[model samples]
Target: MSSLKFYNEEGAGQQNSDLYHYSQAVVLGDIVKCSGQGGWDPTGKLDANDVEGQVDLAFQNVNRVLQAAGLRGWEDVYSVRSYHVDMDASFEFVVDRFKKHCPDHRPIWTCIGVTRLGLPEMLIEIEVEAYAKKA
Candidate 1:
């Protein structure tokens, strides 16, 4: 088994010093499991509160992690989970974004509506699982 690697791109690991158990992505052999990413930028600031902006940022974060792992694109994604504070308002936006990004292949996805999330201003958080051929 290959060892795992982690990343804290937004400096969350440093800010929350006690949060040592989290990682942006973990590489286990040929698979990469990405943690849930919100609509925050590298500076840990909320970029947007609206559905489209939030979804776009969330996918951007995921893409960064996937690129770090040397994966091609969303084609390698096997599963995805999106948490939405307002499902009715955000569902269409999320679907459209997903279609735009991962048009060829459709991965397993789950969209959940929740009352709250880790951040009060965040409207969406996206998590993904991907696999690639061991090189």
Candidate 2:
């Protein structure tokens, strides 16, 4: 059996988690499960004001979490789930960004429209599940 390992965000993530406790990601053997990441940077500030900027920063945060779990890059990602305040607007951008990042690999994806997210200013949130289960 693989034991659970927690990877708490180091800087602003740590501070943010103080409000609500959770890890940025977790590891169990060869699998890495990352938590929802918003457009906030290491300082816990909203780095991107628009949906396009937010989507870009959110992906960066997801990558940051993945690297923290010891994974190389997006090729290790097997699945993705995103939450958007306005699906009509965010849907296209998220898909395009996914293609840009995961160019070599195509992973399962799901998009959800929500009333809001953890942060009121957030436009989108990204979470992923990755494994060494590549064929």
Q: Which has the greatest TM-score? A: 2
lDDT, residue 119, candidate 1: 77
Q: CA lDDT of each candidate?
A: 0.77, 0.83
Mind giving the per-residue lDDT tens digits that candidate 1 earns over 55-128? Answer: 88788878876776677757789899999999998889889888988989898999899998887888899999
Clashes of each: 0, 0
Model 2, runs deviating above 4 Å: 132-135
For residues 25-49, could you state the per-residue lDDT of candidate 2 as single tens digits? 8887788999999888778788435
- Find the 10 residues in a row with the least total lDDT in model 2: 1-10
Please tell me which predicted candidate would have the highest lDDT against the true structure.
2
Candidate 2 collision pairs: none
